[model samples]
Target: MGSFLGFSALFYFLLAINMGNLMVSFSQEGLCSAPPILTSADSSDQPRYWKVTNPTLSPAHLQDLPGFTRSVYKRDHALISPESHMFGPLPYWTNTLGAYLITPAMGSHFVMYLAKMQENSKSGIPPRDVERFIFVVHGAVLLTDISGVTHSLNVDSYAYLPPNSTHSLNCDTSSTLIVIEKRYNYLESHIPDLIVSSTDKQPLVVTPGEGYEYRDLLSASLAHDFNIYIMDYKPGQFLNVKEVHYNQHGVLILEGQGIYRLGDSWYPVQAGDAIWMAPFVPQWYAALGTSRTRYLLYKDGNRNPL
Candidate 1:
C-alpha cells in the first residue's frame, strides 16, 4: 500500500508541473502587442499583451513560448521548428509534409506553418469556412482546385483560397510552402480569385514612403481584407517613418539581412526569420547587408474598427 501511494503521488506531482507550465505558456495571453511607445527610446521590456478567445490553443512548449506578445523570431533559436506530428495528430498531415507550426506567437485568430513536402505526395484541404494562402519557397507543387482546374506552381508562386474553397496539393519535387490560414472576416462583398505567379509577374515599384519600395503581390482590386507584399530595400535603405496603426502583421524575412524597429527597440533580422507585430505597435525596418533585403509581409486591413 505504501509503495502504491508513493507512485501515485509522483504521478500527480508531474501532472501538476506539466499543467503549471502550460498555464505559463499562455499567461501573457498572445504574442506581445502592447500599445506603441511613441518615443524612440528602446522599449524592449515593455509589458506585452495579446488578446485571444482561447489561450489554451496556443503552443505551450517551452521553446515555442514567446516571452512577450511581441517577438523577433530568429530561425536558429527564437522559433520552434517541429516535425510533422510533433504537435500531435493533425487532421490532414502526413510524412510527406513536415509542418512547423509558427502561429502560436500570433494567438488563436490564425495559424501559420512552414511546411516541407516530398515528391509525389498529396494533401487536401477540404471545403471549410476559412481562407488560406500558400506561398511557394523553392521547387514546385501542383495545385488542384474545387473546379477541377490544376496547375503547377514554382518558386515565388502564391495562391489564395477563399472561404469554403476546396483544394488539394500534389508535389512533384521536394518543396517548401508557407501555409497561412485564418478565419474569414467578412467586410467586403467581392473577393477576387487569385493564383499569382510572382516569379513571372513584374513587380510594381510603389513608394509608400521614402527609401523603400514595395512589391505588391495582390492588388487592391482583389478585395482581400489583408494585404501581402514583398518589401525590398537596398543596402543602407530604411523606412524613414515610424508607423502605428490598427493592422497587425506577420512577416517572414525572405532574403538578405536587416534591422526592424518594433515598438522602440531595433532588432537584427535575417533570411528565414519571422515576426509578429500586434496592432498599433510602432514599427519600421532598414536594410543592412550589401545585398538587397526582401521580406514576405502580411497585414490585416480593410476591416471595421473594433
Candidate 2:
C-alpha cells in the first residue's frame, strides 16, 4: 500500500508539471488568461463538431506580407477565430451572450458580428444612424420593425433596417444571427423601406458553375448602399476563378469545410470563420470535404466610384 501510494503521488507530480508547461505554452501564444476548462462533455471523447474552438489551442497567423502594397490598412486579411474571452457578451445584450465581434480592418464603411443568443435574450440595440442587415442562421427571433410590426424571423430569415430606424430583436428560440452593419450613403433617390424575407422563399440563382448557388438577402436598388447574401457551393473545386475587384467584403463561413483564398494567402477555413477582404485583393474559395459549403457575404453597393 505504501509503494502504491508513492507511485500515485509521483504520477500526479509529473502530470502537474506537464500541465504547467502546457499552460505556459498557451500563454506564450497570446492567451490573455488560462485555457478553457476541459470537461468530459467537450473532451476528446466528444466529436470535433461538439467541441468548441479555442484560438490559443490553434493560433491564427498574421497575413501582413511585405510583398503587398500599402494602399490599404496593412491588408491583414486572414481567418478570425474565437480567441480567449474575445467572444464575450456584446454591449447592451442582456441575459446570455457570446457574440463574436468579427470586424476586421476593413475601414469604417462596414462591420459584422456573429452571435448565438438564447430565449429571453436580445440583440444589441443598433445605433440610430447605422443601417443594419440581420440574417438568421439557426432557430428564430421576433423583430419589431420601426413601424411596430413584429416579424417572425426563422432560419434563413433576414431583416434590413434603414438608417435612423429603430427595431427590437428578441429571441423566439436559441438562435444564431449574423448582423452586418454599415453607414448608409444617402442619395437623392427614395430611401428603401424595411425588408424582411427568408432564403427558402427566395429563388436560387445559379452562378458560374452547376453546383454554385446564391441567395440575395436584399434587392439591388439606388436607395440602398450595401447588400448581404449567401453563396452555396457543393463538394468540388471552385477556386480556379480568382477575383480582384474594388468592392471590399465581410464574409462569414456559415457551414462546411473549405479553403478560402484571400489576397495573396490561402487559408483552410471551416464553419464560423469570419474573413475580411480589402478592395482589389484577390479572393476565391473551394468547397472541400463531403458536405456543401455556404457563406454569408457582405459588400458595399449602389454607390458610384468617386
Candidate 3:
C-alpha cells in the first residue's frame, strides 16, 4: 500500500509539471493566459459553450502588444479565453451568455464580437445604424427580421442584416455566434438586400486558380463595400504566386492548418485563428496538414480610392 501510494504521488507530480511546461509554451506563443476551459457546442450532454467573465485586460489594449500590427490580428487570444479585460462598453449585448469584444485589428469599418448565448436568451439590434452579419459557428439560432419573418439558422449559417434593419436573435439552446457590423460605404446608388445562407448549402465554384474552390456568401455586387467567401484548399495545395492587392481582407480559419504569408514572413495558422491584411500587403497561403484547409474570408471592395 505504501509503495502504491508513493507511485501515485509521483505520477501526479510529473503530470502537474508537464501541465506547467505546456502552459509556459502557450504563453511563449503569445497567448495571454492559461488554456481555457472550452466545451464543444455539438455535444448534447455537456454545456454548449464556455463563458468568459471579468477579464483583466481590454481587447483594444491587446493591439498595443509588440507582436500584433495595426493591420493584422493573428488570433482572438484575449477575447476567446477571457484572461484579460480589454473590452470597451458593449451596449448591444444583453444576455446570460457573456460576450468577448474584439477591436478591429485590421480596419476601422467594423465592430466584432464572439457571443455565447443560452436557451431563451433574447438579444439583437433593433433598427441598427450599420450593416451587420451574424454567423453561427456552433449550435443554432432563430433570427427574426424587420418584417417579422423568422429564420432558423444552424451551424455554418450566415445572415446579413442591412443598415437600419430591425432584427432579433434568440436561441433555444446554448450556441456560439460571431456578430460583425460595418457602416456601408456606398459605391453604387442602391442599398443591398439581406443575404442569408449556409455554407454547406452553397455550391462550391471552381476558381481560375488550381487546388482551390470558393463559395461566395456575400459577393461584391450584393454588398456595398465588401465580399465574403468560403475558400477551401486541398492538402498540399498552395497559391501559385505571392500577390498583393489594393483591397484589404479579414480572414478567419475555420478548419485545418496552414502557413499564411503576409508581407515578408510566413506565419502558422489553424482553426479559430484570424488574420487582417492591409491594402497592398503581399499575401499567400499553403495547406500543410493532412486534411483540407478552409477559411471564411472578408475583403473590402467596390469602393473608389479614398
Candidate 4:
C-alpha cells in the first residue's frame, strides 16, 4: 500500500509540474508573442517618394525598368560611336522629334506630334475619329464641336476625346498644339476618320515669330504595356476635356504651375505634383505660370480603337 501511495504521489507531482509549465507557457504566449519578421519584400511594397533636386540627373537604380537602354551620347555636333562592350549608339538629334529624345522606330501604341495652327483660321483642323489628347502648348485655340459650341483653349490647356466625337480647332493666334493619338483595341467602338472642309476660311492674324511650341521631350514606353509622354506648358493656357475609353491615365507635374480639375476636386498643381485618374474621369487644366508647366502623362496599349 505504502509503495503504491508513493508511486501515486510521484505521478501527481509530475502532473502538477507539467501543468504549471503549461500555464507559464500560455501566459508567455499572450504577453510576449514573437515579433513579425521584417523583410525586404515588405519594404518593397511600401510607397516610395522621390523629390527632384536636379531635373537633369537620371533617376537612380532605374536599370531594372523594362526595355531600359542607355541614351546615345553626343558631343558638340559629333555622334560618338559607343564602346563595343557597352550598349548601342546613342540617339542623334535628327532622329529625335519635338522634346522626345527618342521615338519608337516601328509602330507605337500611341503617336505624338507637334503642329502649329495657322493664325486666325476661322476653321482649324476639324475633329476626326481618332482618340486624341491635345495640350495647347502655346497661343490660343477655339475648339468647336459638331453642335457649334466653341470652347477656347490657351497655353497649358488640354483636351481629351472619346472615339467618334466631332471637334475642331480655331486658332485666334498662331498656336502650337501637341497632339497624342492612341491606338484602340478591336473591342473598342470604331472611330471614324476626321472630316474637314477643303475650302479656305478666314484666318486670324498674329505676329508670326512670336508663336513657338514644344512637346513632351521624353516619350517612352513604360512596363512594355503603356506609352508615356511628358508635356510642358506655359502659364495662362487651358487643357481641354474629353471622355476616354479603355485607358486610365496619370499626370505628374515636373515643373511650373497649373490648376487641374479631377472629379469634383479643384487641385492647384505645381512642380513635383501628381494626379491619378481613371477612365472617364472628367478632368481639365489651366496654366497658372508666367513661363511653362511641364508634366508627364502615361497611358496603356498600342492598338487602335475598333
Best by TM-score: 2
Question: How do the residues 1-306 of candidate 3 rate in per-residue lDDT, one tens digit apiece?
Answer: 999999999999999999898898886765555434333532346321122211222234463576443223343221122333233434655553544344455343565566777777767573345788878777888888889999999878989988888888887787777666777776556688878888878889986757789898886573567777889999999888677878766666666678888877667666565566667778889998687788777777777766
Q: List runs of model 4 lying over 4 Å from the truth.
A: 1-107, 122-129, 186-293, 301-306
**Against the hidden true structure, what lDDT does model 3 obtain?**
0.67
Clashes of each: 4, 0, 11, 30
TM-score of structure candidate 4: 0.34
What ranges in model 2 sit over 4 Å off?
1-76, 83-85, 96-100, 104-108, 208-211
Taking the tens digit of each residue's C-alpha lDDT, what string does model 2 give over 1-306?
999999999999999999898798876755565444444543445432221222222222222333432112235464564332255677788654665444544443577876678778886666766788988766778999878999998877888988888788998467767788776778885687899888778788877644578887788888888777788888985755678877878887776677777777777776657777778888888899887888778888788868
Lowest summed lDDT across 10 adjacent residues in model 3 is found at 48-57
What TM-score quantifies how close candidate 3 is to the native fold?
0.69
- Runs with alpha carbons beyond 4 Å of true place in candidate 1: 1-90, 99-101, 199-202
User: Can you write out model 1's per-residue Cα lDDT over 1-306, one digit (the tens) per residue?
Assistant: 999999999999999998887776657554354433344222345211101000221123432454433333442213221211232323574535544445545453567666667766676573366788888876688888879889788777888887887778887677777777777776657765755466448465767558878776765653677767878789999888888887767777776677787776777666666667766778888899777787778877766767
Regarding TM-score, does 1 or 2 come out ahead? Answer: 2
Question: Higher lDDT: candidate 1 or 4?
Answer: 1
| Candidate 1, backbone clash total | 4
**What's the residue-level lDDT of 60 in candidate 2?**
22
Span of 10 residues, lowest total lDDT, candidate 2: 51-60
